[model samples]
Target: MSKILIISAVFAPEPVVSAKLSEDIANELALDYQVVVIAPKPTRPFGFDLQKDENNQTIYRLQNLDSYVFPESKLLGRLKESYSFGLACKKYISQNRKNIDLIYMNSWPIFSQYLIVKTAQKYKIKVVTHVQDVYPESLSNKIPRLSFILRFVFLPIDKFVLKNSFKIIAISNKMKTYLAKTRTLSESKIEVVQNWQNEASFTSYKQKENQDRRIFTYMYLGNIGPVAGVDLIIEAFAQASIPKSKLIIAGSGSKKEELKTFVVKSKIVNVEFLEVPDGKVPEIQGSADVMLLPIKKGAASSSIPSKLPAYMFSKKPIIGSLDIDSATAKVIVESNCGWVVEAENVAELANKMKLSFKSTKGSLLEKGENGFEYAMKNLSKKNNLSQVTNIIKNALL
Candidate 1:
């Protein structure tokens, strides 16, 4: 069998979207191709007891993410990490160049992708890039002061990665369009394939409905990083101050302690914080009356959050604090599962929270069911897996 090397920032057993997608893809591809993965040691939400092997694949677990992903710093850390991972994978590709038929890149942008694409060219290997985010632009949002410099220095590398890819898989049509317009990529080169969750896992698990009937809960789950805007959510939840309503912030990140400090200083008592252990998504999602999906003002203009599908599968109505034009906001509106408010607008988010609390149970349930139905039809893992696999397989052919 021909061999395929998968380069991903995260992989199996890591409970993030990319990890799950990469893991699923690896499993699917292993049926006919010898699969190998190069990924960081699993140190995402938390540290993992590393697994160096899989059933039908080889896993090259490099340095732990803690060594590279410096949450305390700014863009410099990301640049360094990307370069480090890029060079490491470059060395591996050079040694195994003869065996690598194709490289399915779901890794970082600019430096890492450029290095990978360059190495692929030298080895006469085909490359299919799975884009999770539009970089340089995303980086610009982070450091607006140096936006010009970031774009000037890194944008061309990003273009090279896209230009050289045999095919590009974008997670949403919005992303595909954005890449085409911004990166000047050809429409035919970019294919839309959604990031999917295994809905069957929800079927196997029973949702515990043991909450107090009088109280309304709004919950946020996932990373609390720089662009997560959890502080904004906390402040809005406090401003709403709906009697018998509470906001539960679940999951850990670099800013968790700072957020807790802010809450304590502000005397925000209606908000609660807890760490979400892995495999507890169903439990946490089931417990919430409304899911809170918040992204910073410009953080997610084209991409949908991985949690959105899982949130829908849990059958909970959503309230998204995001830009009206964003892909996530569009989904909330289109799916009829949620409401959208301008991101970073505290008063608007507060009003939305209050409205959600005052809404009738029937109205909320209807919306939740609407999202579930949409996810069933549009976000099926099997369908998306086959689409992505075919895109790669066809590219190789």
Candidate 2:
């Protein structure tokens, strides 16, 4: 059996942002390959201690990277922490390289990729880099000086790794185009494996429950991060004067307090932001009549929110505030699964929101039903695993 080692900076049992996708792919790959995962321990937003070693043991292999530089970092603390994590990973991999045949690293801390690159080269193992967000495209433009430093040092290394890697998996087509522009690699070396949802997560199918509710509820699940366009969605919902309609925004983030401040300052009465209980994301989604996916303009090309599959699973019509050409927009429009609007366009979003609520009484339910059917037909975890396995097979050839 091929032994594959997966490295991620953040992971399971903590409800951390990237864990779901990492865990899902790792678990799926485990069906065919022996999988081992490396991840950091949990901490608070401002870096406080939390439950350690309590992560969900089912899906993740869970090796704790113990360094205070991580969960304790403020401002440039992540840079310091990630550098340490990279060093630790390199040391760990160097010591344990004999057991692994291939390496796959998720990019966020970016240093994880760096460690994989270093170790894979030493061990002469194939390495695949899975990008959830684009680097220079997102962060480079945000902070120019830092971006210059990154472009000077990291970007070239990233390009080298991408070119030399056995495979590069992009979460979106736009990201693939971006990488293709910079890297001299065969088209076959690059693949777009969009994010996926677990088939079992759709518990609605397993045991029937009454989904019929009187109130026309709209829900937004996932991070309250700025890039997610949570503020814009609230503004749009504020403008939407639809009576008796409640909007529930679930999940937490760095901007949670700031977003709460905005709601309080603006007196947006209809919108409620709740800290959703971990693993109960479906419970919140199922409670809604419709779902809203709002992404701000100029966020990042790797902007296909992972929540898309969850929204689709909810079987509620989604009104996505994403650019027309964006990955999420393509998914919504192509699947005929939901509606897409330009980011931060409150008027347009409000209009679509009103329309979804008004129209779902009749054929709108049919639209949601269509979305669920499409999700089952196309976006199942099995299909994702098949795609990943096919890519691995092709790369091996």
Candidate 3:
């Protein structure tokens, strides 16, 4: 079997979208190919761990890196982590060049990605890049202080790596188009494969009775990190102050404590914070009446959140606070499953919350059905995963 190397920033034990994707792809590919993975030990949401970690297998090479966890070192720390992981990948590839048939990387951009690709080329190894979020521009949302100057330097290195990669998998068409146009790359170079979630996982969602006695509940699940705009969600929910309605913010990230502080200080009575243990996704999702999808300004131009598929699969209406032209906003409109307000606009978000709260049960259910139908037709996991694995197999043949 041809050996494939999977280099990711995080892996299975890390309970995040990217880590799950990395795990799925690795296990799937392992059936027909010799698969090896190079990833940091579980360290994202601060508390996840893999206790029985073994490093002796030739099929697995896990690394211990200096990556910062949530509520810890912010920007400079991430840069250090990225550089640190990049060196790990580079060293491994340099030592195992003859054994690696191809590399599939879902990792931090600019530093980590560049170093791996640059070194891989020396030995004629092909790399397939999985694009999650567009960087440099997205950096403006993360670290505005140096984005302007850094873009000038980062762009060229970015262009070189992407342009040299054997294949690029962009999660949405809007992102694919944006990359092609802005980077002056060939249209055929990038393929669109959504970071698909397993529909079967949600099939277990039963028609359960609502646990909360509130008239309506809105939920924001997943990371509470910088780009999540979770702060915006908290503020909007507080401002809406809808009677008989409550907001549930679930999952972990860097911004949790600050958001908790904001909620308490603002005297937001109806909002709640949670630490969602694994295996409770369907239950947590099935409880909500509407899904709150909020992204900060300029951040949604290139990518869709991994949560969108889950929200849609749960048959819940979404109220997206995203850019008008963003891929995510377009999906919400086209599916007619939710409402879209201006990204980062507190007033607009509040108004939409009120509107959704007042919507009739029939109207909300109809919207939920619309989103489920859309996910079925467009985001099928089997089809998308086959596309990804085929891209890898054909690259070698």
Candidate 4:
């Protein structure tokens, strides 16, 4: 059997994007491969809890590993955590090197890839790096001084790993291009494989009671991260003219406090924020009249938010505030399932919100139907799994 070792920062039970992607890929690969994951045990972002791993079997079998303090917490903590993760991964690889064929890992906890590469070298194993989000540059670009440090410290190492890898998977074309220019990666080394959603599970559902009382329920579901343009949504939603329309922003992240501050200062009576249980996304998201997907103006447009397929499957009209070149924008335009707003144009976003609230539900529903059809045809997880397996097979051969 082909033996593959997967390393990631998150896995099942966490409900984060990295976890979902890792779990899905491993599960799919298990059909014809022996997959063992090595993932950092889950912990509260602030606290250090080691006991959480003892309670969950699903998380344990899938390769549970020690959790180190997050880097952003402190300089020493970051260095210690990076070293510990690298060492822990090295120790694990030492024990199982003979059984594994290839090492695969995602980008966040950027240093984890270091372990994968080091261990791969020790065992003469192949390596594949998954670029979930544009990294080093992403972290550094958001903080300019760090840009200099990351360009020197992180970017070169990232490029080295990618160059040595047998294949580097990019989530979007733009990501592929950017990585190529930044890293000077060989054109043949990069592969574009857009993340697919579990469409079967995203099927349209019956609208729940009280769904009609709200003028238009505009929802922004998923992580409230800096790159997602949640601040833009908040600013635009705060000044939106649709007094009866309600904007429900769900999920939590580093930006939650800032959002709360905006809500308090703007006194946007029509907007509400909720700490949504990860499992409750379907019900919460499905209740919305429209789903919002916004990307920050200057952020990498290569990413198509994981929420798009869910929005499509939810059968809700989407309002994407992204550049025309973004994968999300292209999908929305081609599917004719939603409207696109300029990334930084708050006025345009507000107008879209007003227009969306006033638009006929039938036309919106029709657009959603078209989107669902397009998704069904092009973005099924099953199809994606097949494609991924093919890539792995080709790489291995």
Best by lDDT: 1
TM-score of candidate 2 on Cα atoms, chains taken together:
0.87
Assess each prediction's global lDDT (C-alpha) against the native. 0.84, 0.72, 0.83, 0.75
lDDT tens per residue, model 2, 52-115:
4444455436687775444432336766777777887788789888987877777444565666
Error of 2 at 25 (Å): 3.5
| lDDT by residue (tens digit), candidate 1, 201-226 | 77577887737977889999887788
Off-target runs (Cα >4 Å) in candidate 4 are 44-60, 71-83, 107-109, 207-210
- TM-score for each model: 0.94, 0.87, 0.93, 0.89
lDDT of 1 at 276: 73
Model 4, residue 45: distance off in Å is: 7.7
Location of the lowest summed lDDT over 10 successive residues in candidate 2: 44-53
lDDT of model number 4? 0.75
- Model 1: how far is 149 from its true place, Å? 0.7
**Number of residue pairs clashing in candidate 3, backbone atoms closer than 3 angstroms, sequence gap of 3 or more or interchain:** 0
Best by TM-score: 1
Q: Between prediction 1 and prediction 3, which has the larger TM-score? A: 1
Model 1 CA deviation exceeding 4 Å by range: 46-73
- TM-score pick, better of 1 and 4: 1
RMSD of 1: 2.6
